[model samples]
Target chain A: MISTASAVIGSRVSVGHRMLALTWLISPLLLLATWALVAASGHYSAQLLIPPADVWHTFKDLLHSGELLEGAAFSLRRLASGFVLGASGGLLFGAALALSKTVEVYCAPMFHVLRQVPSIALIPMFILVFGVEETFKVLLVTKAVFFPVALATSEGIKAIPRSHFEVARLYRLPRYSLLLDVVFPAAAPPILTGLRVGLTRAWMVLVAAELLAADSGLGQMIEMGRQMMRIDVVMVGVITIGLIGFVLDSSLRLLERRLFRWKAIKE
Target chain B: MNASLDQRWLASTSHSPGALQIRELSKHYLLDGQPMEVLKGIDLRVKPGEFVSIVGASGCGKSSLLRLIAGLESDYSGDMQLDGKAITTTSLERGIVFQDHRLFPWKTVAQNIAIALKRSPLTRQEKALRVAEHIRLVNLQGFENAYPHQLSGGMAQRAAIARALITQPKLLLLDEPFGALDALTRISMQRELQRIWVQHRSTMIMVTHDVEEALYLGDRVIVMDARPGRIKYEIDVDLPHPRERHAPRLQELKEILLTELAGSDADK
Candidate 1:
């Protein structure tokens, strides 16, 4: 009975420890409460700053009518398809550049210049080439996702210690086996970080594309609400986009943890 | 089959006058169109099963010679024959342990050892058993799942030893594997290496700047002078494996190495 009590106390201590570790989570809640207070005070006009209660009501109405759900699903699908293709292509291309001196020498300068041009800056060119269609949105996401992943992969591969390469040679690890077993694992953590950054950037770009031209998606829904002067609906759309982005970043972080358990074991 | 291979390894080292025969080995480094000769017509031989330690001042090409034998550097002129086979690129038949543990941070202890076995034709069960056996040989049981970071410097090095031995190589080359360790740990690891070497009986060649370390573990100590390194002198330690640190023969060799290194420094 005494041991059980001690176990209960131990669990409580661990819970307290977790709460302390996650102290940053309180800031967003505080910001939300402050926004509600500012809206209630009517310091800004209602059109510019809708009360949280009204936003909540509009959010519920949109949820009931399934408009928000449909819009979110559409945006998510476009994000996934474009980001996957872009990130995978970037990974392979980056590995090639890092592994081969000739490839790096020939391609590096052009890639460097191209990466500086922001994805949003290319929207007009994309529109001119592909027109204002599904292709344009996907291409925008692809552009956003590609550079970070490529840069991360190249840098990560280069950062691997020379000693490790010597070890690989000493083992006479076959070409494919060396890549699969040593090179990829050594490169994964940074590549995963790049993927997370690329994904979030692509998500933001997709929303911008939808805002500019798309017929459906949360960003377009917000544009429609703005045109109709339904500020509450626009507010709901903004909140949902932010929340979804947060969830995506968190989940990618979880996967990184799983893949890099060996790092933690060493620590 | 295993017994026969071990027997052959023993016989080859015993019957042959030299375990390693290097004749007219030369290496030149080119910098900005200037050719600098690092090793100039070096001729050396290590007798079978002899624990030879090579010592030299920094930039004396001691490490470069070891690298040539380890098959890390192929751009050299000469013949380096081990047990009558010309040394080329790395082979499973030869093993090396470096100063750093060099264990992959992503792999567990068992996984790291298993990587060395991947190219071998051994069955999966046999590989697992051999890996476990080597781990025990290095006294690292119950650490099968531990990552490299989880181990202390000494333990990680021991794991590295196990990985090298897993291939059952004919020759073991150590390039200052304990240099990065603390003084206390270095002594203990030296003792551990002595014990392990006694048990395995492989032809071991270790390189170190520490004269005492070279004297304590080596059967024959070869001292090299500084500029464009070459063998200056050799002292034979007739003491057996797991030899006492305070043994009269070891003490004599230790004093000789100290005076040689000190005399070389004074000459410079």
Candidate 2:
């Protein structure tokens, strides 16, 4: 009876320990404390360094005025459109590059070189051509998203083992089944990783594009805050941007598990 | 006399349609742009509901022979037929299992088995039922939801066998299916395979390096020489299904095969 009872408690202890792991939050708390301490030290001017409470007030003000919502909606709309457009194109282009020798031979070198030219570097040229309109920002995000996803999808398809294709052939699986069941799943992990990278990278690039020239967005709000010397508003925008990136990354990480679950085995 | 008559009755059944006939089959590989003989003048015949095991050295192209019969490659020159139809590109009539259990890691055991029925005419309900039946056929009933990575080597191989047999192919080819297993697992799997053969009575061709295994399970064991693989000889096991493991006939055949194999290697 004692042993059984102890085993029950032992199992519960693991759950209890998981709850206790909230101590991990202390790291972020330490960073906040450091920020507050530096502000209190009065080394920097008031315009440059506003305390955490003032930033919280500015957050509340922005929230109540509906500017935060409007800015977030604008940025997310850009993110969604750019991500969908680029990711689908990347999927098709990557599969083509993997499937056709001629396409690969002709396009692969140029693709590598072009992707190396950062989307941020293209921002000025894009503005000069496309103007400060939404086209410039959205296109910048699309370019940022396209490269990683395409590279990952092509490399993932190439890495599938030859034996698998042979098995598909032996069974005479239909082309649809061969792609959906075998090809897609076989190449999923890397492709999904590429998508997540593309998503986060697009977010960063879009924000930078907005800050450089856009009339509205979290980036524009931050630029306005900087222009008006509202350090507290600038802090709020920075915090919100970091928070959005974290949420996007964490959500995709959740979807990572939804895609496939293969436990690693040594053998 | 009765056993021979029973075998004749089994062979003459029209319901079993896995009869294979091969003649003058030869395969060549371009190693460094020079055509090297992989298989030379190979001839073979298999009756319906028969289990034929081929044992050979590494370079004997036993695996290549299985692949050709599977219709995965057409580079070989041969007159190969299955159930009176010329072997063309891959067809649903043939199935194959490799040394490695090639279960897709992302798919569960049931999904892996069901995918074999992609071209099947069964409805979704029927496919599910067949998947369940095959799971039980391999004694993996509770592990239907388990992924490939969650299974042991032996269990995974059993699942592979289930997947291969689910389509009810005319012929099933196993290329060193149990070679990667441990000694104890290999023995158990051999027993399991024998049981499956006895129950289903499907035509099967297994390629292995183990002489004991070939003699134990096969109705006939064909030995081949390497470096331009050619069938040296074949031995008729002449035993009924589920024979005793320690049968003297099996031991005798093992000795003869061992001697012939070693002598063949020495001639090289």
Candidate 3:
């Protein structure tokens, strides 16, 4: 009984230790501490650098007013639609480039050159062609997502060993079975990584697009706050953007782990 | 009279199914803008349920020969036939296990085996049963749910064997199936493979560098010379299944093979 009690205590202590070791949760707390200390030191004017408490109050006010939530929801919808379009196109195009030598020969060189142009750089041209509307912002996010995903997908397909194809041939697997069972799974780790990278890039580009021209979104909120001299509100928007990007990336990483659990065992 | 009848029955049965006949088999590849011959003027005939081992040094095109037989490489001047049908492309009737187990790392042992049954007309339940049966044949009953990465090298190769055999191919080709294993594991796996072959009695052709392995498992060991690879000689083991490893005949054949290999290296 005494040993069992000690074992329970030991288990509780380890659980607490694990919580402490979660640096992602702890990092923001550390940043908050530093901000509070700097605010108390009075090194700068309050107008120049708002305290964490003031930022918190601004965040609560935005929440209660529902503008922040509405902006976030609208931003997420655009991101989802753009990401889906861009990623699907990327997947098909990438698989084509990998599978067909003729397609690769014609398009690969041009693709390499075109993908070098940043989405932000193309924003002006997109605005001219698409107008400064939802199309422009959505296209910007799509452009951001397409290049990375395509490159990753193509590389992943290329990296598959010839032996895999031989095995498929030996088994005489149907074309659909080859694609679903062999090609997809063999190339998935890199493709999933590509999706994660594309997601974060999409989020970043969407924010940048909103900042430049959007009538709504967290980025627009930040811009409006800046114009109104509400630094605390801008800070809240910035923090929210970072948090959302972090959440998106972490969830993708979680999914990757779950799907490619075999990789972890091999390592 | 009964023994004679049994002998005739066995001969007819062995000659009837899975007979691979290769004639004037030659393969060429372009190297540095020059055509290089890999396999030259080869002729081999493998009877049904016979285990033929081909041994050669590296670069001897032993692997290429296996690939040609497996129909992975078709650019060859050869008349290759299986059970009187021309072998032009990969077929479910021919199964191959590479030097590496080549078990799809993403799949569990059972899934890897089941994937080979995709083209089979067997029902789902029958396929599952066959997969389980083959898994048991390879002594991997408890590892059905385990992924390839989770298995040891020997176990993974066994799983590959199971996968290859699950289709119940008329002929099975193994390209150095135990080449990647440790010495002890290789010995044990060779024994397991012999046992499996005894049980299945399907035509199997294995390519390996190990002379003892070739002699121990093969009904006939074909020794090939490098540089325009061709059969230099063939040694008939004339031994039965579960043969003693230290048999004088095997030891003598191993010495002859080693000398032949070393002599060719000297000639080079």
Q: Over the stretch A1-267, how does candidate 2's per-residue lDDT look in tens digits?
A: 999999999989988898789877988999999989999999987678888888889899999999998998899999889998889888888887887899999999999899899889999999999999999888888888889899999999999999888878877888888888888789988999999999999999999988889889999999999999887888898899999999998998898877766746455
lDDT of 2: 0.89
Fraction of true inter-chain Cα contacts (below 8 Å) kept per model? 0.72, 0.79, 0.86
Predicted candidate 3 versus true structure: per-residue lDDT over A136-160, tens digit per residue: 9888888888888898889999999
Tell me candidate 2's TM-score on chain B.
Answer: 0.94
Q: What does DockQ give for each predicted structure?
A: 0.70, 0.70, 0.69
i-RMSD per candidate, Å = 1.0, 1.3, 1.0
Which regions of candidate 1 fall more than 4 Å away from where they truly are? A1-26, A264-267, B1-18, B30-37
TM-score of A-chain in each prediction?
A: 0.91, 0.92, 0.93
**What lDDT does candidate 2 reach at residue A121?**
95
- Candidate closer to the true structure by DockQ (higher is better), 2 or 3: 2
Candidate 1 structure lDDT: 0.86
Candidates' TM-scores? Answer: 0.90, 0.92, 0.91
Write one digit per residue (lDDT tens) for candidate 1, span A1-267: 999999999999999999999999799779889989998898999888988878889999999999999999999989988998889888988898899999899999998999899898898899999998888888789888889999899999999998888888988888898889898899999999999999999999899889889899999999999899988888899999999999999999999998898885432
Recovered native contacts in candidate 2, as a fraction? 0.79
Model 1 TM: 0.90
Estimate, for each residue in B92-167, the C-alpha lDDT of model 2 and write its tens digit: 7888889999998888999999888888887998788778877877899899999988899999999999898888
Clashing pairs in 3: none
